[model samples]
Target chain A: MPSEFTSTLNSSTLEAGQTQLKIDGLQLNFGGVAALYNISLEVKQSEILAIIGPNGAGKTSLLNCISGLYHPQRGKITYFNSSEHEMTHMKPHQIAQLGVARSFQNIELFRHMTVLDNLLSGCHIHMKTDLFSSMLYWGKAQREHIQFRRFVEDIIDLLEIEAIRYQTVGSLSYGLQKRVEMGRALAMRPSLLLLDEPMAGMNSEEKEDMARFVLDINEEHGVTIVLIEHDMGVVMDISDRIAVLNFGQKIGEGTPDEVRRNPVVIEAYLGEEHSPYPLRSKL
Target chain B: MISGIFHSTYEQDMALRHTHAQKIRLAILIVFLLVFPFLANRYYLTLANQIGIAVIGAIGLNILVGYTGQISLGQGGFMAVGAYTAGILTARMGMPWWASTLVACFVTAGVGAAFGLPSLRLKGLYLAIATLAAQEIILWVVTHWKAVTGGVDALVVPNPELFGIRMNTDFNFYWLVWALVILVTFASVNLFRTRFGRAFIAIRDQDIAASVMGVDLFKYKLLAFAISSFWVGLAGALTAHYRSIVTWERFTIDVSVLYLAMIIIGGLGKITGSYLGAIFMTLLPAVLSNLGRVVKGVFPGVEGIIPFIQQATFGLVIILFLILEPEGLNKIWKNIKDYFRLWPFSY
Candidate 1:
């Protein structure tokens, strides 16, 4: 089954020149304890890949490495954009500039700024107007500001966040704030979107809404998404392929059906005695 | 429709207006600035000069505390460095007044950066302590360095001349000071929209997040320090040249505290607040002095009570402003204008 998953992933690998992200021999350690061991992954153009793991399974660590928040001890993360440049060891903002954007596990919206301003800040890198032009409120600055505002307004509308557009993020509900964070990331107009626990701590309805939003973003926008989530049901339901990590090691990688029947994954999740889900329920 | 055009979030609403209304207002302000020297009598001209000097210093302090969110209790020190540098160059080296002023601003900015070095390692209370130490050290140096600073004795700065016009009259000096204040204020306002200005605000909001977002903290912080000191130094140079006198007593820790008070009483991080604060503080003493003269005529014992009452009132006002209206007089002005703007329908 693992071999079959590998073959599928291999087939998906960037037709020689179109891969969005490639990770090889990734490893991370906190002092003496290894947090990630030789984890490797690939995200091709416009693919939705899910990483599922239990608590302390090095899921966030991998995402951090990809986002340039943490440097992996031994790894090569090569990301190729449409510009024919492969980015390696770039800074977080530099990586962001190369069309990779991320939302945090805990939302990191600029709380002091209004929701509109937060979205506007995400477009800071894209703004063409200089400081002098902005200060003077010149023709170029006004035009550029209007353009960016239109773009941001479209995203806000798409996210269904128009009512609270002028409200501060600090005053928003947690679920709304999370959506705003997604909007902010989307404002960057990233080709590859990394959502860290996109549906974490949400109720069933909120999770369903978020799942629909993610699906719409992926299918309609054709954005390649790499997400870290704990909900196995959501992962199994949406992901084309899933990677399971246990104790800082990749225990299984396969389709949902293949992973469900794997004995090692069952043991890792339910322990030896309670391995079979149907049998345990009956007992 | 007017309010609709101006309607925005707190961030936008607080923005310095550059609209047609503001342009007309600015033109009127320019006219007022041009005519102020001729209209005011000698005492009023002297008062205007003091306001100009204070405004210059306040603008620099506002940049440090308001834009950068770095507490500096050492603006007085930077001012002293500028004053003494100008004083020594002109009085001893026979440097022209203008040349000395320019040299003084640069030298003092360099010294301000030296004082700003500890800010890289220290912040908040620790940063304030570093500045306080700078203030004390600078004052001690100016007092003890008899050769250059002339100790505590007043160093007579020569009467300045510009284009062969001797600035002997208060009106002439008033124009010079007013021009300097306006130029400095304009530059300071423009600085807010720059890369350095954004970085300063970023650091103020969240240093770690700012760094992660590609802002180089060290470079920007140091730049903020340098720019802040440069302005303060310029103010000092103007004061030294305008006064034609320099003494150690001029740049004491008290003056540093007073400058801090000005920024606080005006409003933190607002350019308009600085000007408002300077005018407010500079006029308070004159108002009290006039009141004192009236009371002296009415009550024989009121003469001794005036200084004590003034000092107590100053302290009480600062405390009141901090506790009751920490946003300072700027907010008050905004409220009044907003009330008028909204008129019958208050929001």
Candidate 2:
């Protein structure tokens, strides 16, 4: 069913330079079933791009592919960071080193580590000193560690996670854990950040706060964001451009207003009771 | 203010300690270790030697399980390899003690690698079973190889010498073992701060995650096994030389279990805990033996009440500790110290 939705987007030719990520003709299959089929889309720099779809829509899979967790069998993922084109087919840490970072759908914070330590792990790829210096506690390693800590502390302060900084990540509340995950992603100093359902289980108030943080990150920090979200209201409010997926395929791509009136999206969400144009007012 | 302290350049922060209190404590510990053999009686000296040998084995096991997070039950087997090599080279071939010790360490390391090859494909319980098999095989070879190992006949180990001074006395052997234990413990402490140490911890926490983070698991795991085996082998060599005999029965599955028990009784991933655990477990039997003697002196029929009471006590102690304090005796020590440190405000 989702394969049919993605087939529609596969027919469109992707435009370049406007977005940092230009994914063209991406196809991924698990056994006999296609989890993602010919999904092509672009994410512009300094803009919040939302990928919205119903359950089992392969939204998380797209983020996983971009983060190098799962490599697509077909199609290319070309990302531009600081004017250099880089491929996402490399190792996850390699992608991170190239200034692209991602948070997981489920929280993957190092549970035993303190909140500060979890944030510190994100900076592991950027650490310059090797084992020798670390073991001996030599001058170079000390200086590099201090420098990185300062950078991490700045992000920690921005996220307002100072209260629980010393507490283990396992002890944190769900909303705080999500914020810590974001802080970890920010610690990489990423140019492109992919967030997989940042507010998946949050209360309405928590979602509002998260949406504010997301907006602040894009508008103030000028970081490119590609988020997979289920809440239509939040997606409609925050996203600069929206892409809708059904099953594993991209069914619609346009501005929020344009996607709102799309016939296929209407049918996918509310069944065939209402026409695509009236669903905008219903939303 | 707390952040400022932790914000020291990585080198400064990771430095074993920054305060004069720590320096003084270490100095006092060194002094105590140096004076212990002289002050203690022959029985205490022997107990110290056993603890020292166990400390060495614990350090080796720590490299595999603590630093690398790989479970291994083959340390006792590696120790057997070292013991047999030392026993054969010195007693049969008439090799110099130092040269034979070196050869024993290297040979055992090679044998350890042979067992480690299978570790490349296995992990957790499966890897543990593989090491368990190695333990059995090594014991079999040592017991059956009559020409070199003396088979069932215990191989007599010559008294080790340095500059023509025979290390035959309990005091002399105690010093040798203690010095080696201290050296190994210090080295292991430094090892954990290194890149290899981080790689091991990363693998332990999450292997797939570590691989994605640019760590080559197979290469590092093998390296961990080799280094662990080398140290364990050295302990075995020392053990053989210390006892002045090589008996296959001593390096049995029971000894392997004891080593695992020591690490578990210590904190799983800490160097200090390993040494502390080794000392505690090694001294336990001696303490129990003395207690048994006292009980027998007090009551004539007590020995008849339970023939294998010590063995039962050992198993019970391990179970009790595992249930009540899974973090082991090190946590208890830490808690006591913390309580003292914050005496007035202690919980």
Candidate 3:
């Protein structure tokens, strides 16, 4: 088997609105600089959770930590799946095999490959045939590939990227590229999807389209979403719960309604009179 | 639109040949391959045989370089492993040629995997240099290992026989060479249609992203190296038996560079590209000599410069293609196909 993530997972642990991932005392450092400090957070199953903060607030670093890109020096990240696997020490692919998929802050679509190919590449885990079976490309391998192609087609349709499915990702516009990245991540059939600044560098209409897709991915597909967005209006509108970070520390985390009134989040964004790090926002 | 081509079912969409023209093209190709040996002279057959051998090695190289995006300069060294293995088994161990060839494949795969171990830490140019080091190391070992390898001397390969028929001639060996070439090429073409192929491309494009999508980097990288060298080893065994000699000198670093050149000119990431590149690169010197002969009558004094000019032309051609159309001959073939697919109608 191609290690398709689903077959190995415990199905019962995928219930929406339950605590899916838990991070405790997470700390990351780059020499003298601390990227994340004493960060404790919980992502509930199926809910849209947004991590919002100023630039250098460790929002991306948190996603990187969960995705196993950047290993934290201290902490425990537990993926509450059918089986409990410690995320903190696992390799990136191992964490990914746990049904955890992510998109990059900057779009990382395979520039040379077509949109369809990029999505199919995401189906690496599902198509588990040996070199012999694959080289023959008959019966089981063919069936599995067609099955996954159908699944990827749904993502292409959902994201409305059918027009450019055969086009190379390099030729796609920024908005379409981001959508393709989301589509690629979704092709893994993830239990938890980490989207890093998906709406960055987009017009309002593009942002609106992305917001709908994020909502659809959560509600329709029942996938848990952890979003990082700087557009406060979109974040406030879409996120069920929000976590605020500043200088690698968790300042506040609550429902968007609750987070909007938090003094710490406000102070982090619009700084105190003498603080030089005033963040630009529409919150 | 490609006229009269419509797929109502997923099975049709997943087919290797979906269109009537593609099936027809394949039929034509098969027919041509079958008939070529009869029409060509011994010299042309020799050239064709070289293409067949180079095609096998080039396809293997493509798997490592183009698909998996791992640059290996030790391909020649891996081939030497196959050549020596074939030489030892058929000559020393008294094994059959068929058995020796099969054994060489597995043995070479093992050696390639050992060399590929450093790939986890090294990448790009570093990996290339490491593989180069492996080439030098393998050559050194082959040169020094007197008992096992006969040490820097040529070992005569026994004639390959099928059902008590000793096939000693290049014409006789042409059947074995082309059969394996076609088989390996078929496998290579089909490989990309499956998940492993996609995984290789994914790794090539972005190893980090490929890993995050749940591809085991270590497994696939080693598999690429192993499988690639496995075929190259098969080619080596064939070469040893065909020439009726095995010496480590033939499988030099120069052969590896030539194989790289074949894939580059054929185009990266396409199976058909390997065929084009291999045939073109293998026959390029012959074509150049023919051109040089014609130019000799026009300029009598420049006979010594022909080899220099040929080398320069190869470099110039590669540079021009790299600058003008980096995708190579396969892309040109694709463009021509596209034109015909929409014949009498502009897109």
DockQ values, each candidate: 0.18, 0.20, 0.74
What CAPRI class is candidate 1?
A: incorrect
Docking level of model 2: incorrect
- Listed in order, each prediction's TM-score against the native is 0.79, 0.82, 0.94
Q: What's model 1's TM-score?
A: 0.79
Ranking by DockQ: 3, 2, 1
* lDDT by residue for model 1 (A1-283), tens: 2233112212122343257788888899999989999987877787778887778988888888887778887878888764544454666667776767778898777666578777766665566566446555546655556566667776787788988887988899999989988887777677678899999989988888888888877776677888988887888788776788888898988778787787778766624544456456535
Residue A282 shift from truth in candidate 2, angstroms: 14
Instruction: Residues B1-347, candidate 3: write the lDDT tens digits.
Output: 65555678877766778888899999998899889888989999899898998999889989999899999899899889988899899999999999999999999999999999999889999999999998899889988999989888888888888888776576777788999998998898888877788888888988888889998899989999998999989988888888889898898998888888888889987888999999889888899999999999999998989999999998888888788878988988999999989988977
Between prediction 2 and prediction 3, the one with superior lDDT is 3
* RMSD of candidates 1 onward, in order: 6.8, 7.2, 3.2
Q: lDDT tens digits, residues A11-124, model 3? A: 225677778999999999999999999999999988899998999999999999999989999999999888788889888989888889999998887888889889988877
- The A-chain TM-scores of all the candidates are 0.88, 0.87, 0.91
lDDT at position A105, candidate 3: 91
Clashing pairs in 2: A6-A249, A6-A250, A19-A44, A131-B195, A142-B9, A142-B10, A142-B11
Candidate 2 residue-wise lDDT, B45-80, digit = tens: 888888888888898888898767778888778999
Chain A of candidate 1 compared with the true chain A, TM-score: 0.88
Give each model's whole-structure lDDT: 0.78, 0.78, 0.87
Tell me how candidate 1 scores on lDDT.
Answer: 0.78
